[model samples]
Target: MNNINKNQLFWASCLALLVTSLSFGIRAGILGKLGTDFQLTTAELGTITATAFWGFPLAVVIGGFIVDVIGMKKLLVMAFLFHLLGIVLTIFAQGYWTLFISTLLIGIANGTVEAACNPLVATIYSDNKTTKLNHFHLWFPGGIFLGTLIVILFNSLGLSWQIQVAVMIIPTLVYGYLFSKLEFPVTERVASGVSTSTMYKSVTSPLFIFMFICMFGTAITELFTGQWIDVLLKNVTDNAILILTLTTGVMVIGRGLAKPVVHRFSPQGVLLISAILSALGLYLLSTLTGNSIFFAAFIFGLGVCYFWPTMLGFVAENIPKSGALGLNLMGGAGMFAVSVYTIFMGGFYDKLILQKLPEGANEVDYLNATPGSEMADALNLAKNAAGPEILQATLIVPIILTIGFLGLVIYMRSKKTNLIISK
Candidate 1:
């Protein structure tokens, strides 16, 4: 028998997750810089950023299938190795291809963290999976909060973007060191004696299938928009990362109080309310400008704060038979959906910008737009038209989620008492 320190592992998992989210927040913080430095168009940059999202699913899904066999400890070690290589490569990246490959490696590391930790957190807190998962996932936004501040701090000091990228190495090393010494427990499914064949079949259930598809919507609405949100909110404020900071700050607090929230609303009820708030917040953000967007952002943050973990918890609690594979698959599917939408919508963003420009004009012209210059006028026009339309298009997701979750709430109410997760 192993002497497992549950609290130590939980905090280590949070630190590991912090490294993953730091990459995201730092990447988001530097996206515009990468575009400007590389002379990339919005579409090209989107593809570069989406590299991680795509690679994320690949690792998480594969890791899902083998996490049990290879054990969570080894999987997290793999996360550390990949995280180190990926962060180092990113710090030295010379151009687009290098950036793409490095970001992809980081994405795989991020996926591995989830593959191991989601189940780890759930397994340890077997009695309170949803709240504990929320508590663990709070660091996603929490790390993002720290990441944005890092960007702001580095930018304020006139430090190079490479310096900003290097900051990730610190957390990577910390988590790697912690996990290297910790003892891992068997997964809940393995401990409870769920069979592999049974786990496979659970993934195919109608409820599981439905949740899997819904994962697409939630991921897109959160990750896709969050990736480029600086641009989306630029028309409102020059330093839109502050807006993202504000949103994530609220997420940190809201998720800290999740135990009470989860108990009061039930996971399904919380999801329904969150979907409505997300739709409203996205709509307001699509329309509002100046100071008003702050309130909208708070609503948006509160709305999506619980989405990722709660969805996973719903599956784990309601479909206990599905096991580690199921949880990882759900997380994998969400990232995969974000990967697809980021590229597709990115292309659409470029197309819309193209229509707003003169026949020979390109994004570089817009990027280099100077006050009162022809390209400046064209850039202004595109910002007025294309950007809002992109946000408006994304708004449909949370709106649809509102409808979906409303149905979910009703459906949960109709279920047999034993299947219910409500208070």
Candidate 2:
């Protein structure tokens, strides 16, 4: 048996989760200033921000294979070093390539953390996996709440955004200390002395496949909103910082309140409702003008809050035997899927909005012109030309959510039937 107390395990999980959340906050919260600092086109910045995700899928895939071999303790220590170096390099990135490299390294570290910690948490609290996992994972957004506030504060202080990015080191160091001092539990699935053959078989099971698909759509939904909100809000206002701050604020609140909300409704039910609201919210956001867009963002934030962490919780409860390898495989798969989606969206945004701008029209004009409205004609004369492609691309997310919701419904019904029959 591990010598560590339950409180140590709980706090270690919290600190690890907080680091992940901080990474996201830094990614989204500093969007506008980073764009300005690098003099990057909106399309270019999208690619840069999405670069970290490029490494995520690979790391998780590899992490799953090695986590059991290498042990969680080794991985957690490496996560700190990787994230620290990545953050330091990001601070000095003078151009896009440097930023891209930094993001890729950070992604690997972040992915490794996911691989180690998810399994650790599940094993640590295997008895109440759902409830404990939900509580443990809350810091993912808790960091975002703190991160968003930091962005606002840094702006008020007139500090370099570069410095703000570097500030990630603080939490990185703090978490490193916590993880270093704590004793970690062995993988529960492995601890029972199960054969490696059995563990692999569990991962390949049919239920695992369903959870994978569910997580794939879930990842796309969560990341699409997080990565794109800053860019999307640009359509709503010239005060890009303020708009991003508002969106991040809503995310913080929604995630903070997720546990209570989840207690009332099951994770699957929460996802089902979220998908509908997110789809409706995205449509409203993409089409609305002025103040309505702000409200739309709030609605979208509400819809996205539970999708990511709750999905992790679901896997913990439903697939206790697969352990962290299962969590890493699924979580990493979702992020990998999101990266691919983001790349596609980036290409469409560039071709449809950025590269093909008209001679004199501003992007703001293109955003404000309603579909089939005469303003599009007047606006088309400006600099940028608006196309239906971007609008169509935005709709893909909602379509995905609908498909995912159907899958969840089937899974829920099947699970219930299995339980009753087994009983």
Candidate 3:
């Protein structure tokens, strides 16, 4: 620890996260274009997007097991290879299968970054894991804000979507270079000489199980909504990029100030508050519109900003013996939930559109109602109606999360009190 260049490793990890975030931003930006070019249904598009998440669990869980054996550098190299190949394949993709395979590869790479870096950061900053992790996560939202601006700029300049995707390659290469020669420390579990069986037991503990379930709800609330922002708000707002930028911008600031927040509320307390705020935000998004959407977005962003990092922090602080595997499972579980919700939400949107369509008229008929416009008006109207219904349905997730986190907070407080009394 004394010899390690902590700053370099930390920044390198941030760059890797930036690559992941930029990919997300670019993909969200081009969803409509991809759908139009490929002639896909909403569910099919969601399937493609969801494919990016499928590979995460496979890579992270496996990487977690091997990270101590094969070393973190090997995982970083694997991430780079997959990212490069995935981007190239995505660029050349002409249909569903090709895009799906390409995105799956990128998702694996994204998981690899987290597998390597999350433990890496936690290991280095043992004394300040939560605060440092929160700072580390600032890049996710910050990179998204930058990527959204780039895409919006390219659109204004009549550039292609391919150009927007190409931007990720720069950060990917930069991070790979930064991590090339850095020395990685051993994971906390390994350093502490915790037995493998003990590590495994930590993950299977009751508290871990409870938190794992909550991870699904929090992930669905944040990522599922984030992935669909453009499609959902297209009819209600012409400034989708602006909205995305604003939301992520809020997240960046919120994470930047997370240290003080953590100090005041405690991690579990913050989580409980976040769940309540997220539920409120989703409800407001379902009911509110026009200029009011921005206000609701701000609240929603604030709510989700602390969720991912704080959840990981909880595992790191409380489940120290679970080690990298625990972190890996938490991340993998969250992403897997997002994958399920993406497809489910896509189908839900399609169902709402079908319900809104006039009797005896299918989706094709409504889309082809006017020749030159190419169903633009019809599509807008459908989105406007379907968007609110989707938000309302999604509200169920955070409400569940609120109840779960509330239980956790009470349990943790009682546990702390017991420890103090025993001491």
- Best-fitting candidate, measured by lDDT? 1
lDDT of 2 by residue, 1-423 (tens): 558677876787677667767777767877756765666665677677677787777777788888888888888898889889888988988888998898988888888788887787777777766666656666765676676677778878998778778778887898888888877777877787867777677789887887787777767766766666655555456544454455556666666566677777777777788888777766766677677767876776677667777777777676666767778888888988888777777666655653455556465555455756765554433212332235445667667777777687777879899999999
Q: Which lDDT value does model 1 have at 371?
A: 67
For each candidate, C-alpha RMSD in Å?
2.2, 4.9, 1.4
Worst 10 residues of 2 by lDDT: 380-389
Candidate 2: what lDDT? 0.72
When 1 and 2 are scored with lDDT, the better candidate is 1
lDDT score of residue 94 within candidate 2? 84
Off by over 4 Å in 3: 365-376
Two-way TM-score contest, 2 vs 3, winner: 3
Per-model TM-score, in order, reads: 0.96, 0.86, 0.97
Off by over 4 Å in 2: 241-263, 354-356, 359-392
